[model samples]
Target: MKKLFHIGEYFQEKYSQPLQRIGIDLALGCPHRSNGGFGDGCIFCTEDGARARHLTRVGLNLVEQVACGIEYVKKRYGENVGLIAYFQSFTSTNAPVSRLRELYSLVLSQADFKVVIVSTRPDALPDEVLDYLEELNEKYELFVELGIQSACDRTLQEINRGHDFAAVKNACARLKKRNLKVAGHFILGLPGEDFNDWMYTADQAAALQLDAVKIHQLMVLKNTVLAQRCNQNSNYVKPLNEYDYAAALKSFLQRLPENTLLMRLMGDAPESELISPRWWMKKGQFLSFFKEYFYSDNTQNGNFVLTHTADGTPTLYHPRYRQHFHSLAGAGSEAEKKFAEPSALPERLQKSASEKRPLRLLDIGFGLGGNSFAALAHSEKVSGCALEITALEFDLRTLQAALNLYNPNSKEFNILQELINNGFCRCGNSEIKLLLDDARNTIRKLPEKSFDLLWLDAFSSDVNPELWSQHFFAECFRVMRNDGALLTYSSAPTVRGGLFKAGFTVGETPSFGRKRSGSIAFINMPQEGFVPLSEKEKHIIFDSTAGVPYSDCSLNAAPEKILSQHKKLVERLRRRGVPKWYREKTVKN
Candidate 1:
């Protein structure tokens, strides 16, 4: 047998450790469907109904799943073992940027996770996601594995893969441009192909200049089109028996370039899910056999750098935004104090049941869902009325990311998981609604004056000025009940100005986060727990250019347009004489 270069040895030499990759099903699921207009997924794929896996959280939550894998590794490899967070199964890059960040962050937050392996499809590598990945690669060694399946165009089409070889080539090029370690996935012994075809696939793969390559014996699984064909005519779908498969894989391996890192040699599914040659080989047993057959085993790249705060909860440093998603004080604490408490949402929600009215809620910019989750945690205290929540978010992918944090064992997560998948979560009388689009556009779709509470938890005004624009506030004011209260962590002069100008009676709540006090607004003045704005604050809101608030004229305009309009207004103000109440800083600017 010709000896093949082992990936395990190469990774061990580089990382100076016996590294292992812990595969966690991201549940992003493949976008290509058999019935969808675009195209069906591969004929051998058994990932039916997995794209929205966030909705149907099968088995353990991602974190728990990782923990389980970690324990198993510890038992085998002993303690102090670091592992790569391998995002396996489905197309990992299928969600929004927000979601991708959250998903990546989950692994990065845990100290044991040192490297990340992003497994995605060749056709799904959009420029936006690539850009984000490039930014992440600066902080962490990131490896991107593209599922090429087979290099031949005919084989690709026969498998119902939406894209062709050209697309895969372009995607590999883009990843290489970002200087990311690229891995190409291929399958040996695909139907209607002989050893010569495998050689062709190997040649095509080598030409791509990939850092690594992964190939597994093709197995027809249950419910797959191939499985049905195999049932009808076993000869038509001639899967290599164990002995034949080992020989074919060896042939393909010898043909592959020497420099390529062999990521995977074989793939397997659960016995129940598989309808194959019935070779019940454990992954370890197969790997051991492979080492004796040729050689191998291994683990690099991370995305977010996690920093622990006073409360011990870690915060994720966002690479693109160059900011922390949570407060420096602590993520969990900030969620409870800054967002949930000040809003008095728990109390209001409890009151809704007795009043026989659904507690309508509007959560703006549901980034990590900290605020909403905080409210739900609090709601466990008492029975609340049916919750009619309308959470507006630009990136719906975070739902998948957040859903992966807790296992199905958590009753709350189960409810929330259902909500994330289906755009609504139901538990008894409580109902949570999700609007997965830009808040500006989606806000209009909400019913008028229907919400009793609104949590304005978007990014900072400087980073996200459009959310604090007068137009957004006006729309928010329109959707809120007369007695409704809007709470936000922002106490910026611009934010207060926008709220005040939008016909809200703005007040200061308890101080938290990066501000002296959080903001609370009401259409009707609250009788208690509200403080009127001081003269100093009023001066900043009404007189200073700093308070010259943003305006999204059409409510659907981009942030750049809104900022451009604000700059023009400030210039017009500058053209006029400096007003008496204007700050010296405003006049100089």
Candidate 2:
């Protein structure tokens, strides 16, 4: 509800009529003006004009390029969408203001064209150019995309960005003053940059109030300055592991302001142009790895509070905890008992021949498939009840790992397979199906009122905020039947608030093992004679500043505002008997 507006979203909305995108090759060189040196621009710069060779075949002039681009977009995206004339050549605004206006006007004069997007350097923008952009914006939707590779001056210089860090700040401020939307482009894994640098970049972007941000993992482009550097020294650039990149991205997202539109989490460089990090060739695998990390990790945007310097730069501090973990691997031992307790289902709901229908169970965050196995075991206990389990996993490899760990030939695997094959397995007396994908997106695809029971076993809320927000919880609520119940290992106040907001009648239940005293349970409907939040219960919300119950239907619900209003409720609850762990997580100032 925070008005998420990514570049793609903007394009899709602006061209609600008909959208067309035409790539124009200005053939204009860099502003630096080198004598027959190709400008040797940034290390990662490409001279392919950001257009495929086929477009070049027609002609290199502005009019010819626009004509070719119009045909390409029409063929590729259908004829209905209006056209976006993209000036993708090297530093589109590097030419004189008069030339820039003439070229932009050529594309604008076309009847199908609806918008113009200019990609340029911050240093290139003069007052006269700003005026031209203002004029352009008045006529059509204009987007000014700036390439600010990193917030750290050291990193910027190391990459040979050819500009000072101050230029980025100046450009952003100027764009805002002109009432123009700005998109900041950044690259992770640049030379000499580590995970901390990526985090710092996100913090800087948040502070700068960027409307949208685009992040790309660095790859050495063949024949480019970066490749030459890497070739000169083997250790000049080290490719990040899939896991490391995912973790870095998660951390970056956690620090990013919630309102910032994330234009892209990743980008694809032409295979012909790529050099190192061979693994990056598989874009699908890279994306899958990130998805898996999100489901298994519990951290949200703004979860880490920034202890700042006087100059408003963020400094490092401890991260906020928003969820707890229960160990299921050592369930039979005393150690395991410390984290989780044995299942305590009512006798009526226990395994019985009369309840012959397959037990429909939903397992969220199917990381490692540990909880899915547990659910299978539970179904087995319910005699004659088939365990129809829907296990949602975000990462394909993790799902593969889970399948390998729990082989079909094994006894446990056989039980789960039987449920899938015959609707029920007598050994475990349960049935299950594995749904692999991001639960937030995948859950919406499920038919409404389909699930009977849901196992909310995702990572702690502190690590994965997108999945824990009121918007996602509402989707969970809709998919569940009126009588369905949700069980999770989280005792965090925010999770409780989200559940309540989704219209669940939430209450504390005794937790298993040494993990904690209780877990949260949410019933779809309140008990027939149950009283709404009592004074003591209301106090918990106030004390935690956890906010009012966020139903999925609520629009534009700002997390900060919600938290502020419930501060007293959180405090009052803390005064009562709240767990030490719960009380330790204070509201981020």
Candidate 3:
């Protein structure tokens, strides 16, 4: 499964030990420098960004510096440490391929350097340079890092980045075609940009699918053009405080592709260099809080943890039930694929919503409201379509946790905040009502035959079986309109059996993504149009031991008690040799 990976963790696992990076200043300078491409670098960037300010004092060449950095690593970390030759100084690819080859070959010749990184502006990586880098990869691990700070052209101009977002896209695509490992470096808090702009940049970064990412709050360093700008406009640089940056990182992490290594969360800003946003805590101290923060608030929120699934969407993991709110494939995509699309909900609701009366939707076991929000994304824009959503949630804390974890700039953040601030959220004609009580009891109180679309998003049958019982399904059947369709992500026999018993004409939810088939039931679905469940699944629902469904008649029975009741029914059925498919009919014997 894909996960949020730290650079240190990824390297340690790959190399059998942590690999330290040796910062090597090639002194190659940048294409965007005064003598080359654009105006004097980015407004905020100094030579410190390319090569350390003190690097010229050492007066060491690339190979000599790699040797010295290796010795420094040996003293600092341990002996015989694996080192990555990080060509951090300026644009490593500014030179011709011949000179670039010579410098990179010298660095790779060192026995301890297992990998060499080339950090350069996207505009500097021409096709010829990429071809050369591709060839170099066969001999040594090479990562071509790009500084694509902003996706917006306006933002790029403001920063004096000297290249448009298209150049970054073209360069990354060129490198990707050569199967090169690439990382994009992003700096937040650029001048005249809001949180929305930052979100746009992060989304664009994720779309690149870079091998890794380096995200940091922009540091206002001394003796830079940004300083003068900041001085002129007091609001030019609004630094991120602890919560601000932490929240910002969470938002970026949420959008990041699965398995992309986080190269750095904060910059290596020396105390003597940084101008502001200091004094509260050092970077290390903030990281300690950042590491602990992911775990701390979840304690009050029912053991709910945030984890990314295979497709890079953030999902909620319930440690108590050991269940994930989304599929291992993905969270958002899974909901849209397995739940929303399978039901043809978008089309149906759009039509229903445009009618004189609004469509009514029932969301069972609304954990963090992913399904509701996804459905809303499609239905909210329908002309004249009004919606009434009645959602049943046993634990409100999960929603609270989502608010704490998600970036406030995210749509989910706004949606969740709206739900928390008000008991419900209304978009156009759609209205949602959240129920805090147990669904088994609360669902029964909803108006009968009121819902046009039902999202049966209850917990897994065996894991949290109370909501999957015959009684609960009957209540769902009672509440759904004659034209209503109920969609569920599970095709489990137990769940199917309950739906069948509740008088729903069971059908198969169409295959999507990695999942083949989900379950859906229509109040009066014709067999001609929709996909039907196969004979094997139907037979299992009718005859298999797993077909013994849970039944909580009182609507308040504990899960253990409900299972015991179902066990007795299964025993009785087995003794009677019912469900003829499971019974023996021996004549000659």
Candidate 4:
């Protein structure tokens, strides 16, 4: 596995231990701010001026800020960890040379700090500043981080970044000439830039031979010009999703020099201030993606891209559906919570074992067999239990990707491998029949009243409505025994209504990882474990137009056709006029 040349590794190699940066605000503000106030700062700059959350430099002196920063770091990490004095907030070199000397000398007085880091814009790095930094580098290790947000001059102008690419080039040239270590801060997904533009920026940054680089995602923050623009027109800023950002970051890392240390990969804006691109990924999660990018084959079989869910299990993103194979919260976790527990897998397995019969399961849209494997693993725990699963899947490339991902349950993993390679797999008392075709076609041929439990793990109704239609639910109801229950991760009103329309008792399941609860249905009266929907939920399904389910009597219609028909049905229903009480109640609620 290829490892990232990270700042931590570089620090450990040079200083014998990892160094934690203590961000210190010098209070020397940005020259780009209008009237030298926070209101008209750079479009992306927040009022905090990128200051450390704990340290407010309003009253504290340079020495006092350094002391507070050190205390904060030691309290979080340990007393023995090495420290780096970081002049982080707005242009650190905006002040005169004499003032800079006093502030720099004051912070250097602390014997515990091993290095110094100063962050400023490319335009702010004058020759005098570079000359002084060179003198300081002779005595102690120091790095000058320039805010090179983009390489495209048009994009720089669009973001109100005062400097252009030439400024970055000139700044790097002067810094290198004086033997000063240079670092560049680049942001991906900026306004008016596409994938090629981002690539150009990365290539330009690499050409500078930067000693270190900090890559950030352009985030919309509160009380910024970007936020105001977003309020005016919502689509003005659309951030890259996790998959695209990972691809861009990996490509960016590949273009950088092998020795260039990666200071940071993604941005970490305070949630309270952030307005867009709210990915909410922690440092560790981002690093896991970094490791996955370098080690794993991200683009697999030319059909899917590999990504990790909340529980760190692998899942694939389908380009055609624009959906992931499993929930982002957790693939295995979703399988166990949303399907196994809701369907009462353990109790059913025990009953089947006691009756000396295999528990029959219908796994619909079984992309990668997460639900199947989880069920089999649960069945494995019940000693004498036997399980027979009929898994229906559409894509063959998905099965190929599943074979590549590592699973902890060796038995289940081998079973999936066998099922993919062959048509069926028999291991001990468990059997899985793999049907590689449209679920709508294969489901019609299934024996009636055969399955004891059904796992309806399909994509969202908007993208794959053919599987979630009333007709499909009726087919699932036909196959399930009277006592059998169907469980799905979707709590959409249309899905519950479809189940209700198909002569099944519907209820909500305990929610996991998302706001909406999962849905459970039964052919007859609901089981004791099922919680009935509230009156409002029922009203939306039975009375309101929103509850109207997609209809595909033929069962094998294209998704686009089904979706278009469903939209027309909804429009016609709305045109027919809704009852006043239902309309008011739903609107008020």
The numbered model that scores best in lDDT is: 4
Candidate 2 residue-wise lDDT at 569:
47
Clashes of 3: 3
What ordering of candidates by lDDT runs from best to worst?
4, 3, 1, 2
Best by TM-score: 4
- Which portions of model 2 miss their true places by more than 4 Å? 1-5, 14-20, 49-54, 280-410, 413-589
Model 3 TM-score (2 dp): 0.51
lDDT of 3 by residue, 373-470 (tens): 88777776567777678888887787887775578898778877777778777766677788888888798788898888788887777778888887
Q: Each model's C-alpha lDDT?
A: 0.73, 0.62, 0.78, 0.84
Q: In candidate 2, how many Å is residue 406 off?
A: 5.5
Query: In terms of TM-score, which candidate is stronger, 1 or 4?
Result: 4
**Stretches of candidate 1 above 4 Å error?**
1-309, 314-320, 579-589
Q: What is the lDDT of residue 124 in candidate 1?
A: 85
TM-score of candidate 1 on Cα atoms, chains taken together? 0.48
Best-to-worst ranking by TM-score: 4, 2, 3, 1
* Candidate 1 Cα lDDT to native: 0.73
Against the true structure, candidate 2 has what lDDT?
A: 0.62
Which pairs in model 4 have colliding backbones?
none
> lDDT tens string, model 1, 518-580?
889999857367788887788878877767778887877767777788878878886785353
